[model samples]
Target: MIPPVSAPDFLVKAGWPGAAIVPLAGDASFRRYFRVLDGGRRAVLMDAPPPHEDPRPFIAIAEHLVADGFAAPRILARDLDEGLVLIEDFGDDRLKEHVDAQPDNEMTVYSRAIDLLVDLHKLPAADLPPYDRAVYRREVGLVTEWYCPAIGLAVDEDAYNCAWDSVLPIVEQSASPIVTVLRDYHAENIMLIDQPEAYGLGLLDFQDALAGHPAYDLVSLLQDARRDVPPEIEAAMLARYKALASPPADFDAAYAVLGAQRNAKIIGIFTRLWKRDGKPRYLAYLPRMWGLLERDLAHPALAPVAEWFATNIPADKRHQALQEFALA
Candidate 1:
């Protein structure tokens, strides 16, 4: 994708005239990123077109994270009307690629990530929206609304809502302290930066952050949809966080609930990206998401939702069905 028409002027105003703008990446959203190079200096230009996207929340959250000593990209300049922002470049090393290249270092890197979250949870939550029952219901409802229809299954929508209603209160009453939930805190969004002070990880894609249960972000990391985090590593990371943070007895249950909730939302989202957004690449990840969701459903805390799934979606219609659909 070409840079937005206003990008050159914005870069010039930001003091980087005649910089080379190269496409960096585009995510599941309308936002696109480009790398800006001028002489020896480099920065990233975020193009979040308005009407369908906004950069204000990203700007606010980035500032908050930087001020708190977290390694969020520092915003250099912005134009709200055009939805453009020039921000610091965290370079090319993503935690996902790093772990994939050096499997032996997975434990060490994950320990550092867990420690970062432990420290992060100690701070006061940012003044953001709460991840409450309404948000949880809406997110989890995506499975019923999008995925089920796409797979040609007419589920009991009311029963699905009721199943979630029974178990969401468990998450709300979790003993862990509430803090900023970087709703998409996974390996791909984490940059392996060179700064030791920033714990070697630079945060990204946290604009949708909310004040919610601590387990939410942890679940996002260990139960990643795009990558496979071995069950042993997931267990070790959980132990590491619990030892560092001393969260209450229900932390495990909270993790399971949030895992199921998040995975369910992702399955629906991937389907929607294909059906509504015409982006079929995301469908490749559906099987992995279903696997994680099934594991989460096995937890005793998820019995209500588990029963709902067992009754509505037979075993053949879960991951296997998605695989067949994708191949077709």
Candidate 2:
């Protein structure tokens, strides 16, 4: 996902007087980035599409995290009206890429990262918006409207309705106390700052942060989109998170329901990405997500959900639909 040299070129040619520039890689999003190497100095350039990708919220969140003790990339300069941002270069060591490539050092790496999430959840989020039933329904309903229609399936109207009906209440009731929820607290969004004193992770892509269930991030991390996290590793992480986080009342039940709801919404979204955006790589993550979906459904609290999925989403149909989307 490395962008072309255009951005770096623009910065070097038109940026600060006598500044140097170098293009760096970017991830899959509406955003693009470049490295600014200005006469032995360094900075990163962010190119968000003007009128489409706003940078104000990103600016706000990045500053907030920095003030809150997280090593987010520091903003050097900005042009909100033009949608450009110059930030400190945090290097190319993405947390997901680093851990996946170094299997032997995986646990040590994730343990450290998990601790960061624990701290984030412990912080109060009284001001954040609620991730209520409406939000859950909207996310899941996207499947019925966007994904199902794109795939040419009639979107088993009855099934889509019943599926969410059976699942949302379970998710809502078991929801844990709210916290500063970084919506995409998954691996890809975290950059491992390869430094000495601040070996802590650098948070990125957090403009979507809100206040909601704490376990949501843990699931997002363990059930990552780009890699296969081993069951043993996932178990180890879950146990560690539970031990560190003393959940209120019936935490176990709430966590399970949340996981199921999360996985289901993810599956639909991945499918939608394939059909709607023509991004087929997302389909590869489906097989893994489906298995996780089944496991989460195994929780006794989600029995009705399991039954609904079993009756409505046939094994052959799900498999065939996924393949069609991938091919499409």
Query: Highest TM-score: which candidate?
Result: 1
Off by over 4 Å in 2: 1-15, 18-23, 26-28, 156-166, 169-175, 194-199
Off by over 4 Å in 1: none
After TM-score superposition, what is the CA distance of residue 283 in candidate 2 from its true location, in Å? Answer: 2.4
lDDT of each: 0.93, 0.72
Q: Model 2 misses residue 6 by how many Å?
A: 11
List model 2 lDDT by residue over 1-328, tens digit each.
4543355445554556556555565545567777777676777888886676888777887887777677778887776666778888877788788887888988887887778877777777635567887777777666566655655656466665666677566546654667777767777777888643344687788776776778777877887766778888888887888788776666666667777777778777877776666677777777777777778889887787678767656675554467765565
Q: Residue 270 error for model 2, in Å?
A: 2.7
Q: Which ten residues in a row have the lowest lDDT in candidate 1?
A: 318-327
Best by lDDT: 1
